[model samples]
Target chain A: MNKQLVNIKNVTIGYQSKKVLDSVNMQVNKTDFIGVIGPNGGGKTTLIKSILGLIPIWEGSIDVNIRKSKIGYLPQFNPFDKAFPISVEEVILSGLSGKKHLFKRVNKTDKEHTEVLMKQAGIIHLRSKAIGQLSGGQIQRTLLCRALISKPELLILDEPSTFVDSQFEGELFEWLAELNKQIAIIMVSHDIGTISSHVKTIACVNGHLHYHKSNKITAEQLAHYECPIQIITHGEVPHQVLATHKH
Target chain B: MDFFKGIFEYTFINHALIASLFSSVICGILGSYIVSKRMVFISGGITHASFGGIGMAFYLGLPPFVGAAVFAVLSAFGIEWISKKGNVRNDSSIGILWSLGMAIGIIFIYITPGFTPNLMSYLFGSILTVSTGELVFMGILALVIALFFILFYHPILFVSFDENFAKAQKAPVRLINYSLMLLIALGIVINIRVAGIILVMSMLTLPQNTANLFSNNFKQIILYSILISFAGTMAGLAGSFWLGIPSGASIIFTLTLIFFMGKVLKILIERLKRKQKQFLPVK
Candidate 1:
């Protein structure tokens, strides 16, 4: 492994008094692509939240080698107020909030950087359009631009392909694959088949972390790791292990 | 022309006009956050809760504004604290404080000696009666709000839009939230003089809604809100003066009219565009 990006040791997270995640340990390296898979209520999102410092850990610690701003996050699609008057350019520019001083206004260089990122994300055409008026694919691309504009060392995505169509979903994963050349990525998802092809390793999260060294996990391995999720693959199905389901 | 000339000659009219302009500008800037964050009900709670302080001041024979300020700030912080610390939803806390403040105000007013002071002006504002000192205070508040927005636009925008993302970026989300709540409280208190507790929320939201019809940028909305709100306030003032009615109700009604007008115009323009597109030949 290269430089360690995040080291979560025996972390526990919960809301109220019920323990949602308990004693979860995971290590992320600089060039790692980890796909976190689990059941619906299996602490997958909680683990990501703990890594991003969005929720308080009850038992252990999550230490990050990178600065806070150096960790980029693309959260799940929570519907926004349709009447809010914000443009795509302004939304992307706000990604630099952590990089700049509190009172500092965005300057010419910042605008140029935003423009570059917009072009790379293929959202330059929608830059001046209202965010509410954009299609789902455009909004997803815009959010991706906002996450990448700061040039973070680690990118965490929580179900990045939820609202995305299949065409854009492939493109989104391709972009992430390209981005993984430089930084680390931790993607949490319930969809295992599509994620298996993109990630370098797999981690089964069900209140605890089970690190699988390879992307391909057999049905026996799934039972061994105690991960209850069923993997369903499409197309010619080159992989045979996925077809070895006992259920 | 005669009515306009008669109104311009009075110093009170000048004070009312200036106060109206200043308050409208302040509301335009901060109201964007209130609307975007969906905290209009919380603001409404603070506005009414401040009335508790007003009643306490009446009972204790103190300056009503000072008492209202103290109570408004406390209730604002209190709402935040209870919602965060206790096993209560935010709307529940807002509901608690909203009625608690009103009850406290009524009790204090009932206990106070002598006939109750004419609170009609406070309940339904009399902008023509606004004094020079009040106008100056409004002006200072407008400046403070403008400076705050100018300096912290990025973080405020990020936090308001996506607090989780802002937290990951270490954008001081809690500090921004607290400060905004404080500003909202202060804004409600000051605006009570121009638009009473009953009608003040409209002052905060209607102009922003009207502005949304024209622009989809946050900064542009603020600019348009200020212009639209100022226009509405001026028209309301004139209407109130000519019709011999209360200024607060008139201002709110005028803004409502503007909101409907903007909605109708937008629908008409969209229909026209659709018609034009249908008539054009296929490529």
Candidate 2:
């Protein structure tokens, strides 16, 4: 039996007395690939933030079995000062900083490991380049390498493909699929059809959470959970699946 | 060169030069963080808030630096607190404290009975009149900054770059942030004697921006900023000596000039690289 990685029970999350998520429960196993989908303000990010302990719970409990460093998080791309004077290699090498001593510098082993991860991510050539000079795809790839460098058992990615082009987005999903084989994954994205093919389970978070056992979630089921977004499916029909009005 | 040799013989000139070196080193190291973290506004707030302390010191017949340090540290923590716990936005809080401190300084200076000391020096610096005590204070601060950067280089980098990741790593993110704010406050307080209240913000930003044009490595930026800051200070000091102008204004002008030159140079190099690429045979 696979070990339980996260057991979130009867949890409620909010900000300043306003509740964003209520009565959310989830169980993540050792090898589970969970795709979290919902409309923009439907508490998907709030749920993930609660799990990462970035937000405080108003009620109930969330117990993460793994240590903090064992869980890697890749936040959505936000534009910080690009000319802030940091190299791609240094940015990725910072991933191992959690494991090293606070007072110690990045040791030789850290550099070697960063090198290996850079090579794997196909960014070894851009290792010495400034982060400001990198393309969007290169920055995303560099961030992914940073996220994976510490060998996290559970990786949490927030809209990992929002900044990349479609070609690189496909490759990123493929890379995440490969990484999922060894580690549990929680990917939060608005692209439903894209994640449906990759994740083992589907979680719809809209104030409350609706957990589907498989990735194939129907429009009726999504509406039953009160999630308002339309899911577009590929194939012969290629039609938008809309929720039927009950009233 | 002859001007420097002639000035180097005087004891007060030597003190001024040493003070400039120490201030440049600390500013280079701490300035990198301030610029990268975009805390220039906070530094400015602290610099202005320190004026209150200087006024209080004048009113009470105490050393101005002591009053400035106390008020600066309090305002630094106050700004952090107000932004985090209260409803005031960070920038709004900064603006409030900035003007309030200056107002208090003006009031206290007005109330003092004796003939008011030359406030112009404090307002725009009198580097030529730097005392040994101020030099010692800056020296200690420079040493402290160097040790902090050396010992906690990676952790501080992680904290500065991606704070969420640092928190996940269980790094003391809050401690680092608060400590850095305090350091910025102290740094601004000590630097007041060099660039004074009006021009110290440039001292904290220009060298870092100039170094950023050449390299992005944090260590390289610090080293380069220190060198650049020292060179600018020397040149400005000499300029002020020859022109009979205020050292603080001259120093800031020199640094700003360097910043523009660096920008132009970067554009030229980019254009040159494009020309080279275009001239090459088609692949």
Candidate 3:
């Protein structure tokens, strides 16, 4: 039996006037690679937001044992005006936001470590250059480095593979696979096929939680989602299976 | 040399020169924050709209600077209140408030009594007439802006990049936002004194855009802005002395030339990089 990491029980999440998620229950263990998949506006992002303490839960309780330093997050909506006057290195260094002291100067050791993380994320070459000059893949990788700066134990990636070319998606998944050994991952993705191999479990969310074990994602579950699942399966004709659910 | 010696005969010219440098420095520093916040448009709205305060000050026989600062600060808060529509959708509301504030300012000026001749300078800039007291006040405000940037550097950076994430980090996000508005208010006040309300946005925007050429970090942004502003100020002062131009207009023109130079430099650098990449072997 593995240690439970996150406990969510009967939680209802909504804004001041509207309820988006109702009575959700989920439990994540140390070794569980959970994928929270759901349709758009089915409270997928809202659930993730609640975990990040971004939204108020109208009812129930969500107890996350991890500290901010221990839980890394890759935000879905990267609204940074690309033309912002900042460097790639500076932006990546912001990942250390979780662990940094407000009044203290970022010391030599912090810089050295940030450089190491940038190298690990494979963006060391673009370090000194402006962030605006980087490609979409490079920016995503940079944000990942920022998330990894804390060396977190639990990683929450909100559609990390979105907006990138398919050719590099495999490589990005491979990199994520390597990181999965050291940390539990809860990826909220619509690319079901890509993430199926990397994650250990799937939490099919449509304002609720459906937990599953194993990497094999069934076409039925994919169809059942009514929106999108965050896994890739090894079974069936891939394109036909996807095309069947397109409607 | 003989032609130059003739210009310094008037004490006001010397005062104008000193005042120009002081005003440029203040605007350069505060404007860096504004541009980085992407709030120049908002600040411009504040500056033009702040004229209502000046008219009110004229009506009450008080210093226009005091009224302008008060009204601009109040308006800044109003803008923030209006921005509560999820931060992303409140842009239209901000746009409406911005124009309405300016309209109110213009109306106040129209209704105010007496033939105020130099109000045009306040509408634009009258660098020559800026007094010693105003210069000192600008210095103090500049110092405050600099101090705020230094002391709250991390929180400010965090909020600017990702406000929601910053809030989740349990950072003083609200305080940071309020502080940002306070800084902007100070910026509007200082800008009015230096460039007058009319050309204040020029002082707020031009130097910062030019500075973005070389700066990557926050401190570098401040340094580059000051340097760029100083260069523009010097050129404008020289132009005013030699070409018999209004110091304010000359400053704005010099700043524009500096921004143009920055664009050229950026283009040249990109071309050079492309050339290097083309000539190199692919891995």
Better of 1 and 2 by lDDT: 2
For candidate 2, the per-residue lDDT at A154 reads: 95
Between prediction 1 and prediction 3, which has the larger TM-score? Answer: 1
* Regions of model 2 farther than 4 Å from truth: A234-247
| TM-score per candidate | 0.94, 0.93, 0.87
- Relative to the true interface, what fraction of contacts does candidate 2 keep? 0.54
- Residues B45-156 of candidate 3: C-alpha lDDT, one tens digit per residue: 6776677777778767788888888888887777776776345445665576567766766676677787755677777677777787877777777778778777766657
**Top TM-score: which candidate number?**
1
Best by DockQ: 1
Which candidate ranks first by lDDT, i.e. highest?
Answer: 2
Clashing pairs in 3: A192-A231, A192-A232, A193-A231, A193-A232, A196-A232
Query: What lDDT is reached at residue B13 by model 1?
Result: 84
lDDT of 1 by residue, A30-95 (tens): 989999998878898888878878788899898999898888788776556655667899888767
Q: For model 2, which pairs clash?
A: none
When 1 and 2 are scored with DockQ, the better candidate is: 1
